[model samples]
Target: MAATHDAFTTGKDDGDLRRRNIQTHEKANGGMVYKIEAEDTKKLQKKSNLVAFLDEWEFVIAPLIFTALAFFTRMWRIGLSPIVTWDEAHFGKFGSHYLKREFYFDVHPPLGKMLVGLSGYIAGYNGSFEFKSGERYPEELNYTSMRVFNAFFGAVCIPLAYFTARELNFKRPTVWLVTLMVLCENSYATISRFILLDSMLLCFTFTTTLCWARFHRLQKESFSPEWFFWLFLTGLSIGCVCSVKWVGLFCTALVGLYTVEDLWNKFGDLKMPKVELASHVAARVVGLIVVPMLVYMFSFYLHFLILENSGPGDAQMSSLFQANLRGTEVGKNSPLEVAYGSKATLKNMGYGGGLLHSHVQTYPEGSNQQQVTCYHHKDANNDWFFYPNRDHMDFNPETADVKLVANNDVIRLIHAQTGRNLHSHTVPAPVTKADNEVSCYGNTTIGDDKDHWTIEVVNDAVSSDYSKIRTLTTAFRLRHTVLGCYLRAGNVNLPQWGFKQIETTCVKENKPKDVYTHWNVEAHWNDKLPPGEAKNYKSPFLRDFIHLNVAMMTSNNALVPDPDKQDDLASQYWQWPILNVGLRMCSWDDNTVKYFLLGNPIVYWGSTASLGAIALLILWYLIRWQRGYEELSQHDIDFIHYSAIYPVVGWFLHYLPFVAMARVTYVHHYYPALYFAILSAGFVMDWTTQKLGRRVRWSVYILLYAAVIGLFVLFKDIVFGMQGSHQQWRYLKWFDSWRIVDQ
Candidate 1:
């Protein structure tokens, strides 16, 4: 009897199972006929034990090696580059304060920094204990020690990821997929070892999620003690994370919701209802909410309780202020006395006189010049030192060609006076030196100079005569806007620099003053100025001021948006551009797979296809049922239902890129979205193939993936572009075309 491939049987007489194929005979016009024999199946029947062994071990050993490699990558240059990032400075200071005393008024809680500090402690350095009261060490070395601690935790997250996947009973291949993702993501890797709290935050978040999943899976059991313990642990870990950074409160809220769900799901079907429910809920409160909150508050109180021991005139900084204090003799002054011997004396230096005893300095009523205190001072004893008390000097007029140099020990002011460059070295002794003849500061107005565009003004003040002057004395300084620098100012002949016009309503002496700066430049410079006035401008100060004022003109020809048309800003907020800007800033070469494989542009498009697949599957199921086809078993039904969830889950996963790339500045936020997206994709593939017949399903899946990839490639060039060309795009304020500083 003939047999199909699956049902075919072979016996001792049969050479091979493959040789049992049906044969056909072909005949010519002649009476003789030739019969075709079945093909030999020697190669098909051959199997190597060594190859089989290698295949069996590949899954188990490959991931182990890959995970180790990932660990090494994370630790590659652990403390090699130890510069203190901005966030680290704050966090480390907070930690040091917490370790010393407690009770700090910091915006973030201390646990994350505490954990981070632990690494430095372990690395054979203790920043908290090392520096004495009033001493400052190299912040770079301190930051390195702190980062080493964080890097260890960051590397450990790899295994924690494996444990979370294990909770899902993820296959070896899937575990490898997730491990590789966690290992290689640039955002994750960068923040993982960063001295700030993101690494611990992510670990706690993943742990919390894993616990919740486990509790969900164990639903049938009556409220078990173990479940409650897990709920408590999750809350505790998350609480610790929250105590480190207030941002983690977001994850804490999610954990709270999960705790309630875990409680209800466990005790919902109780016959002895109300009392038991109340009791269980109360237990969850004590164990999860109260205990965890204690941990969180403890971390805060820990920081709050610490006292700030360092002061401006502390012994460590006493050397910096010693020369200034030395110039003025006091009864207590002695050669043997330390720079700042007593804490009481150092504290006295910062004491400002009472308001009633304060002296008020006013600008001249008829003067066009702005009166500002010059903070630079000259000391007789120390010629090149900045005097602390007499540092209160004032800026009397708008001067061109002013050069100011300030260092830790001294202040050097160089200016062109009477057409000869003069230098005033303050601090120890005052000395004036004429070094050059032509002043660097010219009398040409910003836009009027034409060749000398005031690209930007770092600081400026309003003159009493209503003219703007650039000077270091200005506090709460205005930053200028630049667009190839024919700055926005009224007259190019007047001195001008780019200054972003900001409306500031400030109250002083109970009176409100409204202030505004230039934001745009007009289209026709000639039309705005009086006839014959454009050519005679000689003052550089006037030219610079006019150049800045010209930036405020309202014209379509200007590169900057018109103030009237700026209803919707295409740029990010002045203070924060990370989200509005591209991901280029935090990107690293290490996590290319994480950046490209999941929640990437391709994944977003895949989510759309996943939805389409769900719809098609629903229709297929309905038709099969209507035709009275065989009923799908519970397993099949469950598989299909869960499979249907993939599209929604996948869609939700894509929201992270939007949050991280568009809405939020932080990079680690992408993890939750990536985790769910990859999870849904795996499930969708499994269920679709199991139910729809695997023969052609993979082909469809590949095509969908390919199509998405093609779209991303096209968009990548048109939208994101290469990082090197970021200057051309000028996504951020600092990114000017003619920028001289390193990005």
Candidate 2:
């Protein structure tokens, strides 16, 4: 009976345990379901918030999307060519030179090259590639990164144009139009996608213009921090643009004119005090003039600091300047005194003209004497020995004390190797037929009257004291006593047969203003002075900068190609606006990558028509105002007349200036002006559409946008460096002057 009772109690205990376990499991499953529902609700809220934020800033977001697209288009396949194109060959090499700390000479300032170098350095480029034209980039080089950097900056112009248009108070459609205009322009796309300075220049130019426009808009709120910041940035960008190319000066001038106009308007605000006007003047002087000047100088300082080693550009500088550079032949702190019988090189004071040079090659056509030419290089042919009015007189260093050659002394210069006395006569020069020919003659110890030259120290007041004449420091004129002519290094290049050097001639006219007659002893080699120890040497940055500008200006002036010379790619300023020609960036067969820089026909032509329409509108407004038959609201006057005129003036400043330039300008040169032209067009659209109905305006905008997009599609391959067939290219070539031949 006891065993039966124990079994029943154990059964009851097991039943209770099973029921509690089931209840706990059911509660756990229900809690999990509740947690999942809470998570889903939070996610839905986050997504909704994001959608609302996007809707709130749709206009801003849209432009950003467009900018990203522009960037994508510019950066895509930028490295496809894998070789330098156009000026990339030059600018890339300069960048490599900067990376290696090797100095070089270029027509433009060093900031652009420095930026390129910095980009390559950041991209892990080792500066090992030669960057030669048509040469493939080595496998180890990071050429793509440099190209991408340029494209990135180039892409910034799209959004910048959008914002600039907005600042001008254009409608949303006009702003979008300006953005698309820059984004779809093939020339901008092509140039920016390469490793060239134009993209950088354009980026900085747009930045400057945008900053100035912002600053101008805030002119009423003087002393505001935002205004000051924009003003400062404007100055900074101006320095950067000018640092890239002199074409930036036009942008700087635009800002300057705007500043002047702003001040004049303020002056008319008689409510403002004279003290406040003075303050405004001071602020602009600091921002526009002082700040840019400082930045410009600092750029040059950085340039000189980075290029510490002597390089190919050493010969272009002064002896003193070269002496300061490391690895140069001229020792720093070396005595620069000149002595008779010392071999020396005489450089013309005239910019970029070469040293006094004589070679074995005689004048083939006239005089038949050894050619005395100005060779803008350092060669043994440029060496000459100074003598005491004799054909051959050597000063014995050991036997006699050192005698420095002084002013107003009759001296004869003999070609060191040929042993011929410097002679000038009545024979006409090879190129400048009006001037007398200068050559080397009379190899004997004594020379004829033709070789005699009186050394007249320039600005010396005919001093009799010979002790005051310094060799390198003093400027002198070599006047032929018998012929009554001055030795001149005329800026005329000899024929290719004469080695393409500058012609040294004798001019009969004694015009005091003729700077070509001035000469200075540049590099002197003498055994008398003790050699100085090498130490740290620093060159005067301001002086060197000025000298560099003068040299660049002179060289640039000489580089203008003849218009009669047939170059298929060359186009004049007048032809540029009409799209008369296009430049070829690269040409390859169907199997390889190709690029042709041509503008979108619809955008370019439309903008051109819009510009003409703007002109007519301005004329019509002026006539109506004179007749007192027209009334305009303040908003219309500001947005249409005043604001619209800024871009027109900007277009004139950039485009019209090129008309006076004699340089070999191409279609790409007009790009900066093209930006303004597009802006002017957008402004005109905004002004005209103000009076139109919504549907008509929207239809016009849609058609205009559709045209831009269609044209972009048609030219996308060329702009993006895609492979295309010769026949396809031929079909795209709308003008007979467009040479799209396969290479």
Candidate 3:
């Protein structure tokens, strides 16, 4: 016989039900068993609370511990500065732009800034502060909460590393080591303890990596709901990472390479049915490609919907798009058609093109006349008067017939700001030597035959209609009457003396089909003409998204280092891996705490060396395999692919592209690459331990933990809080090139 009784509990049960203990037990054969005493039952009751967590030590307990450490480290004295730091000034201002719901343009996508704005909103920040660098924050602002919000993302990265390693089938110490490395990464902690977007970017980058690992493990579970769930999650992560920064594409590239290899391998599986193969390919297409594209587009849709009002970034978009902004006056009462004496602004139709403009300054090298260039900003200098050619007809108000400008009309464009006429000459252009030099010459009343231009309306690309000229629709090319050269403004930048504006020239080759020569009247003002119907100018979401992205790339590429200006904070790609430099995260002064972005030396050097070792080992192993050696087992092959090769590919995908990039590089740019390198190091360390003896394995683990921890202790203040003179931290000045100490 068996009997049971409910036990007295000190606390309420948070699990399925209260615990039950048997006063007496009986076996299936009806044999009596030993009974539990009250003393033992009380002890069991005391420890019953931990049963739920203890059972899932690897899945639950490990992550919880790592997460707590990560959050504690990141959030420790996070608001010590109490002032705007480097990049915080810019990113925080962008957040304020979002809070204000005003349209703004940046080289990066909107999602990161949107999250910052959301954090600010959640923190009860009024978004009234401009976030100027080194400026003291207001007492009313809850800067701490905002910092904590961003730090939350960085904190989550530790658990993500742990989970990713688990999915890759890494053993105990390797998983723990990987998580610890990220947990103690001072640079990540430092970058996250602010209102910048890098932490959020890092978070999503890690999320994508983890999701890819999970999806990769489910290859055998192909087409299952669980497989589709993980794959869909991977796609969502890709969208999220890319939405933060273009650097996120490196993460996407790694996932893409793995997918391609997987599909190719599946293609060779002859036993697989034809229908199944097609299903696999279709599933991957929808899950990876289409899903990511839709998610990316959805972010832009929200961006467009939120920013309905016009602001500083209005001119960076298409004229049609800008005209639709809430406060824009471009098409409110502006004319619909082009006519003689119409004051208008002509925008170049080429990618990254700008508005045709003229200023009081003259080009020092070109024609030595007033500088006529394509400028990105909208101003009075961009305005021009469409005056009829003196030989053709009078444009005077009393005698003018008000003839509407049509295809092939001869005209003269006089700058409204300086009263200069647009003229072209045979002089070699400063930037493009093959093109004729375009300049502003003479006044409204004084000019020559060189000032005469024939405006040829370009046929509509979609409908082929080219009879009448209209604002923001009809594209026209200006042909010099005497020289027969077409007016063009390509993305070429003029010399510094030319204010770095886009170079405007007359293409001497007479390529009528060239988009650089095509121009459209963007802003028109003619009291004689009626207002255009706003209903006819609807800007589609896809067109705006594509145009904005191209413009962003053009602007981002334009950020090449200017030799004339030396920026000390800027570092080269070669300097990143070797810890050759450190960046000042804020203005160095005694008034505020200083934070420097230098990673723990052991972590940095060890990870980099591990990456190198993997490269060499793979080369040697490949050559041996090609020579018909069966030195590796099935387990080894799996380990190489899942543990070593994945991280190696990810690291290269993230790092190697920086070597070819011309944009200004920074130390933070390497953080994503650093993540993959750390994983590679984990792989190396695990493999080495596997092959070593018991004593040697134990010794290696102890030495590594000590070194990583010791260095982090020495450099902890760099991220946590450092004050006083550089002399105080001179012990950390291992590399002289690292601006750790002042002159």
Best by TM-score: 3
The per-model lDDT (C-alpha) reads 0.37, 0.77, 0.83
373-392: candidate 2 lDDT, tens digit per residue = 88867789888887766533
Q: How does model 3 fare in lDDT?
A: 0.83
Q: What does candidate 3 score on TM?
A: 0.90
> 187-297 in candidate 3: lDDT tens per residue?
988999999889989999999998888888778788888899999999899998888899999999898898889889889999999899899889879888888888888
Q: Give the per-residue lDDT digits (tens) of candidate 1, residues 1-743.
A: 01111111111223343344422222233323222331233333343344345445654575577568556655555554323433556566655543443323333445776675566556544455433322234654455556656766666666666545444444333444445445544445555555667677667656655665455444445468766766677667767656655445555555565556656665766675788778778866876678777887666444323322322211211111222222222112222111101110110010110000000221222121111111111112111111111122342223322222121212111111211111111111101111111111211111112112121222222223212211111111112111121111111111111122110111111111111212111001111222221112121333322322222221111233334453221333221212222232222223221111112334433333555566677788889989998678875664454334432443353342344433323234444444444445444554444434333654655565455445434333222213333333233223232121125
Candidate 2 TM-score, C-alpha based: 0.85
Instruction: Give me the runs in candidate 1 sitting further than 4 Å from their true place.
Output: 1-66, 96-104, 126-145, 169-172, 223-225, 259-276, 305-743
lDDT of 1 at 602: 40
Candidate that beats the other on TM-score, 1 or 3, i.e. the better one = 3
Candidates sorted by TM-score, best first: 3, 2, 1
Per-model TM-score versus the true fold: 0.45, 0.85, 0.90
- RMSD in Å for model 3: 7.6
When summed lDDT is taken over every stretch of 10 residues in candidate 3, the lowest stretch is 1-10
